[model samples]
Target chain A: MKSEKQLVELSLKDDKHFAELVERYEAKLSRYIFHLSSLDSASTEDILQEVFIKVYENLNGYDTSFSFSSWIYRITHNEVISFFRKKKARPQAISPDDVDEDYITLIPDDTDIPKELKRKELAAKVKKAVLELPEKYRDVLVLRYLEDKSYQEISDILKISINNASVLVNRAKEKLKSKLTI
Target chain B: MSKLADKILKKVKKANIKHKPRWQFIAKRIFIWSALIVAIILLSMSVSMIIHQMTVAKPVFSEHFQKREFSPIFKLVPYFWTLISLLLLTFAYFDFKQTKTGHRHRPTIIVASGILVGIIIAAVMVSVRAPHNMEEQLQRHPLYQKMHFDKDFSKGPGALRPLMKSQANNPLAFPKN
Candidate 1:
């Protein structure tokens, strides 16, 4: 395994290598945040920059003992959630009535979902349902189900305990089930 | 896979952005020009000092005899040390600013340079005053006079400093060191 310091030194030498980290995580994270937020490309792009800048700033604090991917993804998740918080305030012009309820769900995407997208629309529904849940529960749910992270990964990312993550996910799921049904 | 991942990849790719040519240009421009100005001034001062010292020395030290006159501030070590340190720092700052590798360390460099400036000022002040104070102590204190700068010199200066002291009362309330 390469040491974190070695990777950092390489990243310092080449911005392209640092670009590789962006290529690695940006889309899925963007999807995760987009489901949470109704943010457009420019806004998502702005928050995404904040996430990477935070990662660059705190890379030295990365406990080499942990996975670098998880650490950075955790930061991305936090950034999006905070984006929701700030944007949620000041009363959005988007009212709850403006949301359409005409979402379609065919056969759980078992046939067409690429293996990489193992959960497919199931994950998308979970993300949508998660966004509908109470704020606290929604963040945990999206990080857990949409990302398909292990409970420990969820805990590490959320800065919560394993048990809290588990509990939050369950509460989020129950709320999601109720929300998705309607 | 690339298409499925494209949207997410877009986010990450944006993060690894080639921060626009304009911002890079600005960072490099500001850093390089400031560093060049500082280097030029420091270089001119050092060169002039060396030329002045060599030109002004009395003949006993100026002729083929060739003895160097040491300024109290410049003496006791190599003259290029401070200049070399500044040059290295300027190189580091511009290098970081140009490459995007050193933004996090900008704070460290700023704080370290501030401390270095403080230390250099204190060193210059102490270097100027120490010899003058020692000369006065040498003539005034017989106990220190008998101990004139030898194996016992270290202890003698500390002993003499106490006798020359006047008032411990700092009534004018200066800033704490």
Candidate 2:
């Protein structure tokens, strides 16, 4: 398999190759955009398109030192931020219906909470809890657990130091724990 | 590819989006840095100029104390420069934030650093420019000259005498020497 860097190089030369790059990342990035911003699918798609276009526009500027996925995620993060700034509103809450078993399993277990709760019920509560979080904490949690990005990758994507990113994740988890406990 | 991806891919082709040449990115970044540097320098100059003027432009201590009414005075020019400089520094700060890797630090840290750097530069520039005798210069202006002679100078034949070139030598009142 060609590496992501090779694909970026190839995409620079051939537009069709860029389609392959888009196909490679679209689903993961889309799901992330949806969860991270609680944006509706159409707005998420528009922002995603802008992100890809921005990626193509600055392909030569991509630093080899960073992972390609981190670079893409950073662009998407910027676009989402810009989108919210232009709209001048807080991110809308995600629908509980958007929660799935993956996220349900991803949630950290609480011993105090009843272990007998069904997956669906737990998922719904988790979904609402995640949505109620402040944007900073929510972003860290989404990138860390939902997108399964490393601390370094989250730092790169969010343009924060690795220590700060780790601190943020811990804080976010604490916030989530508190929310879920209630 | 999914339908949305296909549509975006098609749009990408139609947009004729291509990799910006490496040199272009380099050049753009250089330009932004240069602009930021210039803005910082200008901001420093503005601040230092204001500080220097304020320190130097005061009325003589004896004259100020002797006066009965503490007449309110307005001098907008010095503060106007300061305002402009602050505005430029603000723009430069935002520009710096937009640069690649610019977002790594907290904004409060960035602002505090920017201000500290600006003050350091202002200190250096003010020392170098050292506007000596700005107080004397302020005292010799036409407005002050009219005030020295009382408004009657402007209302009477003295006004017809045409302003003297050696206004700098004129004193409002000779101090005990």
lDDT of 1 at B112: 71
TM-score of each: 0.41, 0.68
Q: What is the DockQ of each candidate?
A: 0.01, 0.33
lDDT of 1: 0.51
Residues A1-182, model 1: lDDT tens digits: 44545665566555445556666667867776565565666887878777876665554455555567668877887887677677774212232333222222212223333345334444555445545567778667656655677877766666655666777777766665566555
CAPRI-style grade of the A/B interface in model 2: acceptable
Task: Give the candidate number with the greatest DockQ.
Answer: 2
Instruction: Give per-residue CA lDDT, model 2, range A5-80, as digits (tens).
Output: 9998998887777888888899988988877667788898899889988998999999887899999998998998
User: Where in model 2 is the C-alpha error above 4 Å?
Assistant: A37-50, A78-98, A102-112, A150-152, A159-171, B1-8, B14-24, B54-85, B130-177
